[model samples]
Target: MYGFTIVENLQKIDQDIKRQELKYHQKRVMVSKEFSFDAAHHLHCYEGKCKNLHGHTYKVIFGISGFVDDIGLVIDFGEIKKIWKEQIEIHLDHRYLNDTLPNMNTTAENMVVWIYEKMEESLESDQKDCRVEFVKLYETPTSFAEARREWMTHE
Candidate 1:
């Protein structure tokens, strides 16, 4: 009876270890970061109020998805923040978005897409563990625009 109990306990321990190993091996996680900038813009074609230069405290949200690597991280938050600051935030902060992206009118929708593209391009070049999943651009606290790739759309 004593021997049988010992065998049963060992089997249970082995199963628990296997379960933990499987959990560690199966990797799916999503991480996100947010940034903000204040920028001015004007629409060239607008005949109304927006034709004049205007500014907004823009807030940006970025979502990244992928398996956490062996180090148990999707990607370093600092790295993402750095990329954002360098690629998007610093350039647009307190400056005219229209002057930077002159080819496209700096509407909220177009800015969102442009941000998404910037994030995608930066992440593709910098981070290998995760991909830029979504981008949201807030023109104001109440108004915002979002853009996602066709592959990333949820149904």
Candidate 2:
């Protein structure tokens, strides 16, 4: 009985090691990160509560789909934060969205598209293997808007 248990445990450990090795060699991965910012904006030519100036502690989620390099990562999360903060947050955080993006109507739908564009601009590589996959923005606790690269491409 003791010999049988030892063999079973060895087999399990070997199987687990093989799984980890396979994961390390995985070529493609989906990486995502979430961030939040506070900003105020008012919709133009709209008939609703959003038309009046207001603020929201907005939440944003970014997704990247890419081929993992030798480091076994699509991109570092810290790098993502730095890119977002420099490219987008500096202009939007604690500022009026209307003034920052004058052409945009300051709606969540519009803002998400703008964010996606900024992310694309920040990336150094144009390789198709890695790219911005999606953006999810929450204007309110229950209400949100999202854009996906596949959806945008069709449009």
Candidate 3:
């Protein structure tokens, strides 16, 4: 069995490690973040129960890729959260999907693409060489729709 051990000494910058050693490699990497929100929506011209207004605790996952910066960071989790909160989630969380989102059917498939685009748009303005790799929007725990970078770029 593994035993817990307390840290004895914290490495000091410039003494134990140099600033040049902060970045470990020069390779592209991907980071992911997931967030959840609750919203109500009704599908248009649908032939199912979803035609009526219903609510779901939706989940969204983002995959972003880029070359790491000097500090071995591709993008900080907090920065991703900030982008989600400020640019994307504002139009999503707790808002009526049919009204808040751009005119669409409000389906997970559509939403995922919208999310990918929004993140890409934000990254273009804020991050250097960072791009959205994929976005998965979950309408239910077992159901989701995904948008990928290749798919987006080709079309």
Candidate 4:
């Protein structure tokens, strides 16, 4: 009976250690990437300088959150770029925003939301434990907008 009790306690201790390791590995981490594009846009109803068609060296930062995988990376940098190339870069880079996203105004606020949604769709099929966390858009060097998945809704 003494030997059996000792074995049981050791097994319990081992299980607890494994559980803690799993929990540590499963904790969320965030990774962000930045991209640049040149695009032109004009705000339709704006009463400011944005009303006229103008070009900007736009900057975008994308954030993703998830558990670190066996490779110890939240997500690969190249993978993020590939996703952007497919989901956003190809259409928006060097294109007129009004012509590219005709359904909506090309304000930074609206564009940020659109980027988040597009990235979300592209990441939906990911087999990893990751999701889009946030998107920041810079229409100018200092002027920008941001969106987070928790604050925006999909229809």
Candidate 5:
């Protein structure tokens, strides 16, 4: 059987580790965050069930990559949430997609790209060294559309 042992002393910042040692590596890293929103919309000029007015609880995932800062952190997860809430989710959560989004089909494919662009733009505006690596938007539990940096930048 395995045994558990209690700690004898807590590691103090200055006593156990120096401030200069806070950052342990210089390698670039990727961090991701997921968010969900519910919105209503209907596709234009399409002969399908989705053409009818409908709604979906959408899920979006963002993968951002960059070199770590002094603390060995790529980007704070809370910063990602703040960016999503203030810059992206404001136009998405509980709103009419057809009205809020730019003129487009409102399909997962289109939305994923738009979401990726928005995140990229936000990061650029903040002058953050990080870049959006990819974005995945799920229209359904089993159906998702993805936008990758290579495809966006190369094309």
Candidate 6:
């Protein structure tokens, strides 16, 4: 009877250790930052003509994904937003997108990639663990563009 009880307690301790390990690896988290800017652009060429200058109140959404750290947070959302505001919105807002971005053609697709690149640079400079997973740029109420880093090849 004494030996059986000792074995049962050892098994329980093993199970508890397994549970803790599972909990540690099972942590997945995502954090996002949102920013907006108003920018004007004209497509250089079009059949029906979006050639005329126009502007949109553009909305940009950035997503960062990773396993939560021991602190149980992927990253501080406020810090991400501040980076976006400084690096993107402050520069692009009330400006011509084509003129503001060097070598960028200012289409929604190009703008999305540009935003992604800027966020990537800023995140790296800040020494942040989270990466710029994806960028979504809303050009209009019904139209948008999305770009992902080459590393985000899964989606």
Clashes of each: 0, 0, 0, 0, 0, 0
Instruction: Give the winner by TM-score.
Output: 3
**What TM-score does structure 3 among the candidates reach?**
0.97
Query: Candidate 2 residues 1-155, lDDT tens each?
Result: 35543455554544666545534766667899999999999999999998999999999999988887654677788888888888889988999999998497999999999988888778744344667889999998898999898977763
| Ten contiguous residues with the weakest lDDT in model 3 | 146-155
Evaluate all candidate structures by whole-model CA lDDT and list the values in order: 0.80, 0.83, 0.95, 0.85, 0.94, 0.76
Specify the highest-lDDT model's number: 3
Model 6 spans with C-alpha error above 4 angstroms: 1-26, 150-155
Measured on C-alpha atoms, candidate 2 has an lDDT of 0.83
Q: Which tens-of-lDDT digit does each residue in 53-92 have in candidate 6?
A: 8889998889877666654567778878788778878779
Candidate 5, residue 13: lDDT: 91
Full ranking by lDDT:
3, 5, 4, 2, 1, 6
- Which of the two candidates, 2 or 3, achieves a greater lDDT against the reference? 3
Instruction: Supply the global lDDT for candidate 4.
Output: 0.85
Model 1: per-residue lDDT, tens digit, 30-133? 78899988888898788998899888898999988878665467788998899988887777898877777748988988888878888888988888857777
Measured with C-alpha atoms, the lDDT of residue 4 in candidate 1 is: 43
Query: Candidate 2 or 6, higher lDDT?
Result: 2
TM-score of 1: 0.78
TM-score of each: 0.78, 0.80, 0.97, 0.80, 0.94, 0.74
User: For model 4, how does the per-residue alpha-carbon lDDT over 5-55 read when each residue is reduced to its tens digit?
Assistant: 345455454466554453446578999999999998899888999899999
